[model samples]
Target: MRDIHQVHTLTEAVLDPILAREPAAPRVTYYDDATDARIELSGLTLANWAAKTANLIRDEFGLSPGARVAVLLPAHWQTAAVLLGCWWAGAEVVLHPDADADLALVTLDRVDESEGVGEVAALSLDAMGTPVRDLPVGVTDFATAVRVHGDQFLPRGAGVALDGMPVAEVLAQARKAAARQGFSEVDRVLSSTPWDTTAELIDGYVAVLAAGASLVQVVNPDPAQRERRIVSERVTAQRG
Candidate 1:
């Protein structure tokens, strides 16, 4: 396992080490109240998804360093993979839908809003990774497209990170946020916070990675399930 303090980029520094040491340990656990769905991703599993997403961006989409990919998804495990994948592919993740992006990722409900993008992929956010059917002519189904991509990625360069921020800067912010949030390497963090902005992404998601902590992310959370979830997941920290 690589030393967390000695690492730099998000994937290379935080995730890769988990792959080397804790391949089977759960890194991210996701829940959706509306669908009554839950998904757990181990370190190696998350890396595989990130790598496939990277391959889809680089090989299938023909994107390279500095390319902007607009992401209009919510807080979920797939969103985590998408963010890491873009960084792994040396592409920047643009949060807004109309950011003049080369690639756009959105949910089915927002597909109509994806104008001016060179390419578009709609995610179903399905627990079973089902492909979205009946998509508009130009939209690609992320589940279907990503399944055909490779699971081992070698980035061509170290591109800019979220919203044009540098990788080092983002990772540094994550480290600080982890400390401020009282995160530790052994903590199992439970966060209901949405990664709607660059700040939230750093504070909520990246901090867990930086601190070598596990995350139990809940979207559209059910208050009644909160206590049960914490107990079931063995959560040690809480944040919203």
Candidate 2:
């Protein structure tokens, strides 16, 4: 595996290498304080989900390198899979709801907000892979939809990483953010930060990938569980 610094995108530099080197190691762990749910993914498993997502977007939605994918999802393990898939398919991720996109990835409640921008796929956010209930007639259920796709995929090529920024620039910024936060490959970071913007995405999400660090991302964090998670998850660093 090459160094993390030698990267075109996270899917190429980070995910691919991690899968090749430590396919069974826990790379990402997620927690939902509201539901009291937890999920863990190894590098191979994450790559499989990402490959399925890439296949869905590239084949079903006709998305390519230049296409934009609006992500209305939160910071969860599934979100990480979707984002990696988008990057693998060479689509630019749009965090802003107002942006035009070829695809919109959203949770069940945000269906109406993704209108006016291509196709929409709703996520149930259920760890059990349940299909989202009451999805609109045209809207696709992400968990069910993504499952039909094959786990093997070839890159369509890479473009901008997020919004209008170039892929190289976005990754470089993420690397800097990782360094600023003192991230290292051996660290397991527990993070509660929201990736609601490009900057936050770089700081909270991409930085972990850039540094080749393991992640324990929490949403709706329960304060009481933080200490327990740090010990249980063997977290070496904290990020918010």
Candidate 3:
């Protein structure tokens, strides 16, 4: 595996090592409450999704470096793809839909109601990442469009920072936090905190990635099922 120390940006520093060292290792496991849906993405698979989403943002939307893309989805696997993809496309990610942004990726319900968003894309988050059958006039279906794109993406320039913090600093802080929390490569970290905010970027995703650990996230979790899953998945640490 490439040394995480040599990487500059969050994308390269956090994700690339996992993809290189253990491409097939279980990286992210997600559970949704409303539908009792479960989805898992390995290192290679997550990279592929990120790449496709990057292509969708770069090619279809014509968004380049310095552009802002608003992400309005919950803490699903696809949200991870969209977040990484935005950084891969050299654009900043805005968490709020109303922020000044060039494009917006949203859930199905928000497609019709989100006004003033430059362009709108919808994600179904189905088992297959399916596209909506009847999208309102101009909304792009993310899942369908992403499938046709390439599985790998290489940005032309160096990595960029978010929220005025250098990417390297962000990783360093995450590492310190992870150490304090007793996280390590041997641990499977379980996080129930909503990964929709900027705080989660550091505390949830970065911390786990920095430790070379995997994440088990439960959305709308049932108490009984959560206990079973923690044991089944061998989760060692938790953040709720």
lDDT of each: 0.86, 0.85, 0.78
Off by over 4 Å in 1: 1-9
Model 1 lDDT at residue 89: 80
User: What would the TM-scores of all predictions be?
Assistant: 0.93, 0.93, 0.89
Clashing pairs in 3: none
Ranking by lDDT: 1, 2, 3
Cα lDDT tens digits, model 2, 1-240, are 333223365478667667766788888898989888889998889899999999999999888776889999888899999999988888889897854788899997888888887899999978889999988999998898888899988884676778888678887888899999999888899999998888988899888878888899999998999999899999999988
Tens digit of per-residue lDDT, candidate 3, span 98-189: 64677889887777546787888888877776678788888888888888999889774333445545566777888987888888887898
Q: Roughly what TM-score does model 3 have, to 2 decimal places?
A: 0.89
Backbone Cα, N, C clashes tallied per candidate:
0, 0, 0
Score candidate 2 by lDDT: 0.85
What's the lDDT for residue 226 in model 2?
A: 90
Deviation in Å, model 1, residue 91 alpha carbon: 1.0
Worst 10 residues of 1 by lDDT: 1-10
To one decimal, what is the Cα RMSD in angstroms of model 1 from the true structure?
4.0
